[model samples]
Target: MDTTTNALRWVFLFLMHHPDIQDRMCTEIEGVVRRDMIPMLEDRSKLPFCEAVCFEVMRLGKGSPHTAPHTMKQDTEINGCVIPKGVPVVFNLNSINSDPEIFPDPSTFNPDRFLTGDGRLQGTEKMATSSMGRRSCMGESLAMMELFLFVMALVQRYKIKIEP
Candidate 1:
């Protein structure tokens, strides 16, 4: 629940801070979904910009700063460093999420970064928000659906504003 709530709060904060982005999201939502009805899961694929905004928010927000602790099953070498068996390892999601190679000017809030030239929402494997392997987040799909519905509904109903 914390993860979902935090994600929502961060997205809303980003939208409030960037009215241009917020307006773009609203426009995108209005185009795909009728204002008289709430957005449905089926509408997710049509809202590329809105999906990008959600992805951008998750990437920049550091929803899961570190993945669950992992232990080495056997001795291994990574980049010339020996990792002995039974050693615990923690993956830092922030480093990957902010990597300049994958996300240029990563500190900047740019939803277009998650979009292709043809305007499609790109995958977020590089962000590494969810744990890998058997420990991966089981609610990933649910979380995404909730994000789309909640964000779409909110943007469609009202314009977000940041009070100074």
Candidate 2:
């Protein structure tokens, strides 16, 4: 619940800060979905820009800054440094999400980064916002769906503006 709420909040805040992006999203939504009708799952594929915005929100929000502490099961080497078994390791998701190498201009709220040249949502395997492997977020799909629906609904119906 918190994850979804935070994602929505960040999305709205970003939209308010970047009216140009918000207008682009609204234009995209209005192109496919009728003004009187709410967006549905079938419309998901048609809204690549909206999907990118949602991904950017999650990336910039860094809702879960660190994963649950994981203990080393065996001796391992990372970047030539040896890690012994039983050592606790907390993956810094914020660092990964903001890494310049992975996300160019990491601090900027640019949804286009998530979009391909053809305007499709690129796979998020490298984003690392959602923890990877066995302990990854189980609610990832649900959260994404909720974020998409909520964002589409909000942007379609109103103009988001920042207050003084």
Candidate lDDT (C-alpha), each: 0.85, 0.88
- Candidate 1 weakest ten by summed lDDT: 123-132
Tell me the tens digit of each residue's lDDT in model 1 across 1-164: 67779998998788888999988988888888887899898998899899888888888988888988899999999999999999999888898888999999999999898888999877666667776667778987688778878888988888888776
1-164 per-residue lDDT for model 2 (tens digits): 78889998898788888999999998899899998899987899999999889888999988999888889999999999999999998889999999999998999999999888999889567776668788788988888898889889888888888778
Clashing pairs in 2: none
What TM-score against the true fold does each predicted structure earn?
A: 0.94, 0.94
**Number of backbone collisions per candidate:** 0, 0
Local lDDT at 145 for model 2 = 91
Which candidate leads the pack in lDDT? 2
List ranges where model 2 is wrong by over 4 Å: none
